[model samples]
Target: MRNPLSDTIVNIPPSGIRKFFDVVSEMKGAISLGVGEPDFDTPWHIREEGIYSLEKGRTFYTSNSGLKELRQEICHYLKRRQRLEYDPNTEVMVTVGGSEAIDIALRAMLNPGDEVLIPQPSYVSYVPCTVLAGGTPVIIELEEKDEFRLTPEKLLEKITPKTKVLILPFPNNPTGAIMNRTDLEAIAKVIEEKDLFVLSDEIYSELTYSGKHVSIAEISGMRDRTVLINGFSKAYAMTGWRLGYAAAPALILKQMLKIHQFAIMCAPTTSQYAAVDALRNGDEDIARMKKAYDERRRYLLREFRALGMDCFEPYGAFYMFPCIKRFGMTSDEFANRLLQEEKLALVPGTAFGNCGEGYLRVSYAYSLEDLQKAIERIKRFVARLDGEKKC
Candidate 1:
């Protein structure tokens, strides 16, 4: 038999976040802060909407683009939340999740050998998606000092003639970083001058601890060149709803929709109906959950700092990237030893990218009680490491 896999697919490693999550799953009495999922249930109103759709016998596939109502609501959301306008009829698309939008956006944009500028310590899917799209992944290593926001200088250093797209994974995943408007303006200037398109993943937009989350599409001259991706998973606790959206220029979106229909046909009928409700009546639910997450974020930051852990202030997302360097152990080693000795599971930093060494991604999506328990275990585990260091 011939080799069963394409070389491109074969070389890509599985998600680093899931490794510790799998181990902790089988271990007894384990406390996992690994997965970046919300602790809240899908808000009652949103779930009820899905049930109503099913009760009404609306369980068929939506259009290739998605339910017209949902797409319109998505556009309203962009307009109302981000001060940006999109045409639901031609410029918006509903996807399986933000992950799908990322994949297809790359597929729709890149040709053979196109270079994509991807900053490291970002969400895990960007590099693999670029490769699968036949684009070369050029990594821009974000600095801790920069709070993981992409700088124009860093972006300029990596761009080549082949560079076609830049991925803006702000309100970032593992590091919990966000690029303020000024930071984005500088990046916008570079992208516009270089004539690059961008994939701005703003799935965590609603979960920001700072002020309102700004989209790069809001930048002058950027609306036409940016694909703005977002979803209900982080904001409305709708992760299992398996829904997300992208707002792009009509020309680009037309191509993306073609791929979406051939591959997926449409998003779930029930999810789309429910998402319409989420957009229309779920602002309060988002405010409630975001409040809880912010509390948890502050609590974790305080606790970690009190323990003398070195972590910069992360203004967005629910994850914290804390430096584990003082313990003189690799992030994987530290995470593994904590799991083995204390049955606590947190993902290793190196799982994100090579530059993520000496750090660990800690999620605040768990409850305060669970977080407190996890902290007790971490406190004990690190004390042991402190003792070992003395020896």
Candidate 2:
């Protein structure tokens, strides 16, 4: 007997983030700050719309491009929030989630051996999707000193003849960093200079605290070259709903639609109907959730500092990437011991990339009660480690 799996997948290890998540899942009484999803329900109105659609027997498969009304809503949301315009009919395609949109976009754009510039530590899917699509993932390690943002100088240094696209993951994951307009414009200058296409993942755009979210597509000359990937996951708390959309140049969108047409057929019809409600009537929910996350963000930053971990105050997203290098333990070892000793689960920095090595990503998506418990647990864990060191 012989193994029949493809070498590309067989050689690759499982997702580092998921490895701990699987361990945590089977444990009793474990509070998970490990996942990047919100704890809220998808608002009453959004739920009602899905229910209403089902009641009306609107369960048939929708057009491959998704519901027209939902796309229009997405168009309005993008323009109203980030000042990016897209013709909903030709330039947009609704995918199962931002994850699927990411996959399809890479497949539609990159030829074999094409290189895509990705900034770390980013969402985990970009590098894997690039490889699966036969493209090379050229990771640019974002610096902690620069608030973990991808600077133009760093980007420019990474590009070569094979660089086909750049994947912009901000407001970023794990690091909870955001790029303001000035930061975006500086990179926009390089994008124009290089004539590179971009996959801008702005799923956490609504979760920014310090400044307004600026889309690269809003910059001049970028609208045509940038493929905007956003969805109802983060801001609307619709993660399990599996609803996300992509906006791109008509030609690029058409090609992506073909992939979606074949691979997914269409996004879930009920979710599409519910997403319209989320777009039209979920602003208050977004505001409420953002407020809670902001409060948690501030509290966690204060706690991390008090606990002796050097933390960069996150301005966006619901995670805090605090440097635990002072503890003199590798991120993975610390994370595992913390879980075993104190029953707390956190993603190790190296899960995101090598640049993430000395830190730990702590998600603030739990309730204040849960967060407080986690903090106490972590404090005791650190104290135990300190006592052991002194001994």
Candidate 3:
């Protein structure tokens, strides 16, 4: 028998974040600041909606694009939250999660050997999804000095004739960098000039700590060229529900739906029903959770600074990217040694991209109590390292 495996599938490395998460899961009394999931459970009202759907025997599959009501609610939510408009009938489709939407979008858009400009350190899925879609992954190494925001200069430098998709992963993972309107307008100018499309992953949009989250899709001349990806996972703590959606021009959405229809049929029905409730009535829930996350974010920033580490003050999402270069070790080495010696798990920044090598992504998604304990352990580890250096 031939040893048969497609090089594309085999060559893709496993998620770097999950490797550490799994190790921490098996260890007794381990505190993980690694996983990006919200520590809060799904808001009760949203869960009640899912339960209500089940009770009413609404378990049948939705249309390939998803339940009409749910899609309308998604469109409404996007409009209310981000000032972006979409037609539920033709522009929106529910997905399993933001992950599935991302995969299908790439598949629908990429021609073989097309180049996708991905900025790092970003969410882990972008590179692999682009690769599996038969696209070339062109990485833009986002710099710490810029707070990890992707500049228009960097964007222009990476563009070429083959560049087809620019992945905008703002309120960025690993690094909690966000692009405000001015920042986005600069990039949009380039995209319009170059005739490129954008896949804007705004999964963390609702988690922004600063002013309201801005969508590049809302910029002039951008809506037709942007596929906006967002979901309830971060804001409503609905990660387990596995519901997300993509909104784009009808033409792009039609192609994406074809792939989704054949591959996934539709997102889970119960999840979609619950998501409708989430969108329609979950604003207060978002404010409540965002407040909690903000408290944790500030606490972590203060603690990290007090511990004598250089941490970027994250204005979005629930993670902080702290520079660990002072420790004179690679991100992996610091993370592994901290986990082994202190029973605290932090993801190495390199997990996101090589640009993350000197940093560590510490999620503040845990409770203040857990974060306090983790900080204590981390401080002890750092102190020990400093003492050794002095010796």
lDDT of 2 by residue, 36-68 (tens): 989888898899999999999999999999999
| TM-scores of all candidate predictions against the true structure | 0.99, 0.98, 0.99
Tell me the whole-model lDDT of each prediction, alpha carbons only.
Answer: 0.92, 0.91, 0.93
lDDT of 1 by residue, 102-194 (tens): 999999999999999999898889999999999999999998999998999999999999999999998998999999999999999999999
What TM-score should be assigned to candidate 2? 0.98
Worst 10 residues of 3 by lDDT: 75-84
Total clashing pairs in model 2: 0
Judged by lDDT relative to the true structure, which candidate is superior, 2 or 3? 3
Residue-pair clashes per candidate: 0, 0, 0
Local lDDT at 337 for model 1: 91
Q: What does the lDDT read for residue 240 in candidate 2?
A: 92
List ranges where model 1 is wrong by over 4 Å: none
Which tens-of-lDDT digit does each residue in 1-391 have in candidate 3? 9869988899899999988877888999999988888889998989999999999999998899999999988878887877888999999999999999999999999999999999999999999999989999999999988888989999999999999999999999988899999999999999999999999999999889889899999999999999999887998998998988999999999999999989999999999999888888898999999999999999988988998899878898889999999889999999999999999999999999999999999998889999999989998999999999999
